[model samples]
Target: MSNKVIKEPSNQLEYIISSKQEHEYSKAVNKLFDLALTYIEDAEKGNRLGRKAAWTQGVFEAPLFYACDTVPISAIDLGRLSSRNSVQIAEEAFDLPKETCSMISVLLGEWVLRNNSSVKRVVAFNNACEPFNMAYELIREQGYDVFRVEGAIRPKLNHDGRLDQVIKFLSGELGDLAVWLTGKQLDESRMAREIARMNRILAKVRTVMELRLKNSLYIKSLPTMFILMGSGHYFGKPDEFEAVLDELIDELNSSDVIPSPLGKVIPLTWIGARGLEFGVYKAVDDCGGALLSWFTPNPYDRNWREDVPPLESMARYILDYFLVGSPVHQIKGIERMIEQSSSKGIFFYHYVGCAFGGVHVEIFRDYFKKRGIPSIGLDGCFQVGAPSGQLLTRVRAFIEMFS
Candidate 1:
């Protein structure tokens, strides 16, 4: 055998959409990225906006395209910048929260700040809320221009009207320049595929640990050292995603099985609206945690279950959902995982200052605690920058406590 295991294809000339159980996604992010990739070749050939982003690189490329007189519309979703100048600049410019929005943005922010050299005017949107807005404030202050995209109504299933408005607003805001849409797509197929790839990758990683656990490499921990690239969007692309998934299989086959007694095994569930930050996921894993799955959608999220919009319907949905043993929201999943896993405690990384997440974290923590499940909450800008030693230190402590 040629030791060459082919995966899903990455050969589409334009953008590609892959499904997990294999459904088609043609909305919002999928459409936007498809549109962008349609122009990758032209961009790389050097358009007026300068180099259009080529698809052959790792994740999102820096020094992004900027046509003359047109500052591209971009979205940032991880990490943060810590500098006196940058911090002060953000405070003076907007009616923003200096204290709350400290130093955390998405992965794209850091990439743009470091790469796009000729970007004279830059605008960024912060739908992620709280610390994201705060982080934007700092980015604005630091000589890097950013605009905050206030959270509009988050749409539920059959709410194409809201998604339409979101897309329209983004397209409008993008203006005449080539728009850069970064982050997760709310496509069920794509999400499922991502979850599937994650499942496969984690299975490989867990295999080694399983061998150590049972002396037979039988049951594994799930994906541990997964490298789905491009802000973890590779998981969204059926082909490139499968590339990384296939890659993980090889890595698992060649590496040493982690011998146990593995102290404090952590099986986690992560949920972010667009998606969770991969950087935080990696750092958590580095500190000895197994991400069960980053479930961006709550069970009530139009994906796993139907989302009831109005309070009457929502309340009814909740009452009925739990009654049927299908926990309605994200909390239900956490509760279910703790009930199912071998983990000792739950760690909640509340996106440093995400408002919705802050509220959700508290809610989830409370729900789990009532069941006697221990959960730890941490503060930081997840992917916009390198996770400081402070984070690792905290994780170490958590793991030790697990032991």
Candidate 2:
């Protein structure tokens, strides 16, 4: 995990884009990964000791990743690299249960095997779900400095001083981490700059989300998702990410009827984690449908009110992130997406071994059923290997039901 160049990613796309010559997006994604790795390398080499944050924060934003020089690596990314044997490597090394091992377990194993030396600190948040809780404990047992944070989730929707409470809790936890890691207080200027960069990234993300509905764009939703989400570890160089996004918007604006997989162009809403499967998005389009909304975790998922304090603004962003709280919030998010996109159907993605997602699928399915919206469930992890003849057939059938 040092600045020492490791083996190339087994996945061809990761390989293609990791190359400097492929595309702006390829370069941007690789740049983000490299930047995060550089920090880890620095930490490993004692250049910046104790500045690393292991994100047991689940899908919520880790402000320190960009706001400061600390390295922030998501546990989800640490587990599932495109290599077929990455999980096995984790399983053997961590003595993880073979039968019921979830992605998070495998991911912790991967991080343990690959990044144990560089990871000096671990940050866990409440309400990320059970598997994440278990993973957090495992990290602590492994002897890294661990910090637990409270997330914004109240029993009653709107209570007195809820916002204030959330802000206080958020600041307390992150602020303490900042002090512990860097021995400095939160940098207002640095946080503001990072917020500004994130705002721009989010704006582009919204545009891409909207443009996915446009049949004439002819671009796949996967790249847009990847660019917006940035391999789930860090979003490096907003300008570079924006460059690729601008190219896409230009292409979409210039085109009238670009070729696409969406046969009859029936728009659908994707309700699940992001980056689980690019193939499913393509499959939906290929089966005469358009995936207008893929509800993965977005840090800047909402409008950043200039009226609010930067720290509070960042807190609110994480509070409202799609994956932060309960399934009620997720259901509301799906309902809003459906209304906004005017989607004809919903596709619930369940990663094969993720109980959190699996449990929520039934809830989503039931909700959609009550709404009289036809929804289908698909299974996969974070790769293109999700789509199969059976899955494609199910997608086609689902689209046909609407047609």
Candidate 3:
């Protein structure tokens, strides 16, 4: 056997550390990093304090694991932090194609290298993409206890209680997943508590998003994305995460606004997958542009219903996600975000391997162009590196148009 190992990337922590020293929300950012480090270390050790640690396929499925007493660490989040070497290891080990989604490849690479051996269980869904489903199968073949949830695709034309039926089916599936994880029936009370806790964090995130629109200089683009995405699993510490959000909110609310380092801020809305490179956001910042909002299906943008049955409510939350609807619905969502953020342009970036997002770039670009709004689509892999010359040029040109 070839002796090789995939070590967890420290670049993410490095970025967070640098940001804490330079950014406005130092206290909260530091806390967030500490919490994330604790969780990652615990996960690598095979549990969170005492609960089972499971790799979760998507953010939406995290709450189910939380309620079922499992710590749901996001596999995609891990992939986002992966270094190029780690990705290569995954591709070679799994015989993954060059066209395989980078996120899936990175996670599989980490698993195959036994970098995250403590996470012996995987909670995956079928709704994300084909490669993700394939990853689930591969994980099972690797001797993992994998639980797959059947994701419901929202009907484009809802008629005759079709939406309700989808909700019911998905709820049942989630219920089954909950029981499978814990060998006990789904606990509605615990589910409600978890949902409530997440809702609090989401509400705070919404406030920060609003603040970003009003005070675009208060935070940077990459950190905004990080904060919003953290709502997915709360870095495996809900209480600490909440406190971090509170601290960040207070800082943003009280801090005096400062002029952009590059004068004349051009507000923009990012509409696709977040590139793993920090330079992607730095390029925008260098161009005197601020990404005020992102048009994506973020759980932080909405709340789960605490008044309803927890499983059914979770199902509704999934169905109600902006991405679950038709293209028209997604377009409308983008329009609302642009209007709210007063964005002068749209930055649509997608990984070359993300077929689902890549195909829609032109559709959205054309739709927004007709309305006289400028937009640009960039395609690249989610690898940790500096932005390409062409990428920087396009970003500079796009922002210069507004300038």
The candidate scoring highest on lDDT is: 3
For residues 141-162, write the lDDT of model 2, one tens digit per residue: 7776777766666434657877
Best by TM-score: 3
Give the poorly placed runs of model 1, Cα more than 4 Å off. 1-97, 103-127, 130-232, 235-242, 253-256, 260-289, 295-328, 333-341, 351-353, 381-394
Q: What is candidate 2's CA lDDT for residue 149? A: 68
Residue 385, model 2, lDDT = 36
Best first by lDDT, ranked: 3, 2, 1
Error in Å for residue 135 of model 3: 1.3
Model 2 residue 116 lDDT score: 46
Return the TM-score for candidate 2, rounded to 2 decimals: 0.78
Candidate 3 per-residue C-alpha lDDT over 59-117 given as tens digits, one digit per residue, 9 for 90 to 100? 67666778887777777677665666877887777888887887777778877876444
Counted clashes in each candidate structure: 27, 4, 1
What's the best-to-worst order under TM-score?
3, 2, 1
Off by over 4 Å in 3: 1-14, 46-49
Cα lDDT for residue 156, candidate 3: 72
Candidate 3 lDDT (Cα, whole model)?
0.75
lDDT of 1 by residue, 1-403 (tens): 1224334322221102221111122122233234334332233234335632322121211112211112222232222112224333444444445444443323334433443443323444333344544545554555654433333433443275655565455433323222332332223343234334434533533333333232212112212212212222332233443444444344445545543345544555443332222344444544556655333322222221223222122222222321122223446554554444455677665555556566666666677778786667776553323456676577667766655
- Provide the TM-score for each candidate, comma-separated: 0.47, 0.78, 0.91
